[model samples]
Target: MATATTTAVFPLLLLFAAAVAVPSSPYLSPTTLFQNYQKMLTNFKIFIYTPAKPFTFQNPAASLFYSSLLNSPFLTQEPTEAHLFLIPFSPETSTRSLARLVRDLRINHPYWNRSLGADHFFVSPTGIDYSADRNALELKKNSVQISVFPVISGKFIPHKDITLPPVNLAARFISAVPENASTSSFLGYLKWDGKTESNFVEELRKDGDFLIDIERELLDPVENVKNSKFCLLFYAGDVAWMVEAMALGCVPVVIVDRPIQDLPLTDVLRWSDLGLLVAARGGAKRLKEVLNDVSEEKYNVMREMASAASKHLVWNEEPQPLDAFHMVIYQLWLRRHTIRYARRESF
Candidate 1:
């Protein structure tokens, strides 16, 4: 019995030794893994052309959108590289001229059609006049994805088939202060010139609630907001700024004219869902009630939820605008690859 046990243990030991000795494939090796990761990252080269200087939220949205794609398990880091190209918005370079330039590049560049193709995405928030007006819809039909966020209407002809993705508000990071807190009740800080029309301020004042407005102060609004239980967003400026306010632990009272219609992201984000949102017309009374009823326990719970949601705002996280952009690019790449493979096999 002792001899048999020894024999069994010997074989097991040998097997273990053999397993340890065998080298993993280069793809599995640590050095190889790092190299492949770097290689994968080089795949998608993003080229952004923005004439509106100083890298504003609109331009940064494109970068943030692509960065979000890194969260996907299917995304090989090499296949999603990005680059930015800036064009000047000048009187000499009219919007029509820029549009012509974009069209010319798509038609003239050979690789532009193959690798860059219509699937290669472009975002211009300023207007076609600032960049190139090459019809994004036409590019999308061909296989490139182009998104334009025009500051004004009637600048670019609307594409009948292509619908712009909804603008997402980072709702998860918002926190509401309980009524029992000794701090100020003000909800948000804004650069109010005393001339800018704010529906929130007007409504609150009408409801006999006083609002503290500190216009154009370089002072940190977060410090003021931290002491307050609530902050107010009168109009939609940049979704990022809204998210920033939420990060500081204040609940937002978003004031919108059409509560549901004007916003592009009404489907995924509801005012009630974030425990935020006040309609321009009938929200003042509702806002007061919500503020008054919030208890310490409930406020803490909402704060946690908002913090969890804020994680999605990070560039390399799922369910963001970048993931949508990656899906479009990958689909186009697979289609083209399949066609080429089929032709090769036939030949």
Candidate 2:
């Protein structure tokens, strides 16, 4: 009886051993196992590089803008970590030179290229203060992932490599100005001090019978423009001045020949949008037509739309710049990851 019991127990033990010996799945390769492990360990880290200490409104603005990436709802509940590196550089650095420096840093530093992925880089164009020569276009061309929160002058143009959408000031304009105001007319400040010149002013005065200049009781020069139908913005100014004009609820007649590349026109204005567009280099003849074509009804409708648009431009609120930065970073990250995965597959 003891021998028979031992035989039954031995068979049972053998069956258990057999089960343990069976592999998880013959189809599972070593490469697959390694990939799974790699995926588990890899967490892409974003590196933000600034030229100065993050103190001023510009730096905070940049921080707030980039912070949106971590706040994204689509990502998992697990927290992600990113690094910010502030390099103290002279405010006098030219944009062209900065672009070259960034390119050189990325190329020479093996850690930047090999240890960290391309998506890790976030190069800020402006430092603590605004720089005139900082070319965002050049940086976009050289860097793997470049994000610019430029306090753009009217002169900044988008290069082919830069994927940023036009920075729309329409919302800002609408928010700063009173939407309830019935008048669509604006007075443009085109003070001919030999520094700035506009052909539209001369043409409109001659062709459309529009008032060119008026003497007012106020001491300030801009005060006279308050009652005018529209102010012609032939050139771009410092961000503060532009914001002031928008705050005054004055409709800007943008007359720059190049496209309003910085304004997010598509987001704020449709193709049928009613704002007057005068060609900068095309002469005042087209501007006169645009001025004449606008009827009071059309003007009022545009003013209403423009007002509604302004409500969206709350400066303290989550700005469009934040959203724009997140978009470019995510896109580059995805592309980089896809390439990495493809390389692994080929092996």
Candidate 3:
């Protein structure tokens, strides 16, 4: 296990540094800012709009969302006294459906027309949050969007919009993989939507000495990652699989087409130390070289880092401080304080 390139010491040092350094930043990150408003979060006022169809509770994201908000310490049933208005809907919930809901609410409520939805927010539980729809466009410009998959560029104003964490594994959902799980396998979880090119997968297979497969079966993603040491992720910046990989003790090998502007829990976790990154230009050809450089000892250390970080990724019925649920709220809280949207002329 005495490898020259990698060791567990690096992660331990990085983790220690993050613990000390985050508190001393000149400007506070969302998680830091959340401390000032922690007390208010429980009483944080929110008025949830009634949709034409009830919000789905069957999906994990939907179910956990209901529990987080309704059980939120900041629950407020009254619209007038609320700090923000929440309209919760699933990924399949269309722009037209939402617009109609808002239109109906605006007709009945003073809030929507009051400021053209500046203080209001809605949840889009999809991988792509930006919309081409007219009403969705207006809200993008005027109101805050609490989204799991956020486009942080011209699509959505990062300061105004909330980038939510994906639904985390509940305590009940955690698979009991041992802490010292073997990682001899590398599983690339790819969507064959023309994104996972054939050439790329072929090149990886040729790179050899590793059991690399894009095999799909009737198994949970977490279970696959748990058995593997490395989980290959592509076009994953907009998704929460990275967090899931880390929590499951798999060092994620994230291949990106461009520079990563931001990531979940940036303030809390030092991701560079915990995983591998490959540029998309000839990225597959470079995968073996990248993982080879990381010694087994170093890989083990990274696994430890992921295990520690996993706790923060969990969702409990009663939300815990800095857990996934609180992280979503913290981002929302941070955005509310970070940006002050002007009234949209008149509602």
Which candidate achieves the best TM-score against the true structure?
A: 3
Q: Which stretches of candidate 1 lie above 4 Å from their native place? A: 1-93, 111-118, 127-193, 198-200, 206-210, 216-220, 236-241, 259-272, 289-301, 308-347
Q: Give lDDT per model, in order.
A: 0.40, 0.39, 0.57
| Model 2 residue 170 distance off true place after TM-score fit, in angstroms | 16
The CA lDDT at 37 in model 3 is 38
lDDT of 2 at 3: 39
Residues 272-340 of candidate 1: C-alpha lDDT, one tens digit per residue: 434466565665676677667777666654544343333323332344321234323332332333211
Q: Residue 94's C-alpha lDDT in candidate 2?
A: 62
RMSD of each: 14.8, 19.0, 9.1
Across 1-347, the per-residue lDDT of candidate 3 in tens digits comes to 11211242345334433543443221224344434334344445677876656546554654675677876655666777777777666658666776666666677888766666776777654423445654555566667765444344444454465555555444325544346555444434432223465667666656544344344433565555666677676654324555666666777677776666344545445667776677767656576677667877777777776665665566677665556676566555544433334554322
Query: 37-155, model 2: which lDDT tens digit per residue?
Result: 22322433443344443332244334444455445322333223442121223335566665565555557544333422323334343422223333333233323333232224433
Give the runs in model 2 whose Cα sits over 4 Å from its true position.
1-47, 50-91, 94-138, 142-194, 198-200, 203-226, 236-249, 264-274, 281-285, 311-347
Top candidate when judged by lDDT against the true structure: 3
TM-score of 1: 0.47
lDDT of 1 at 305: 39
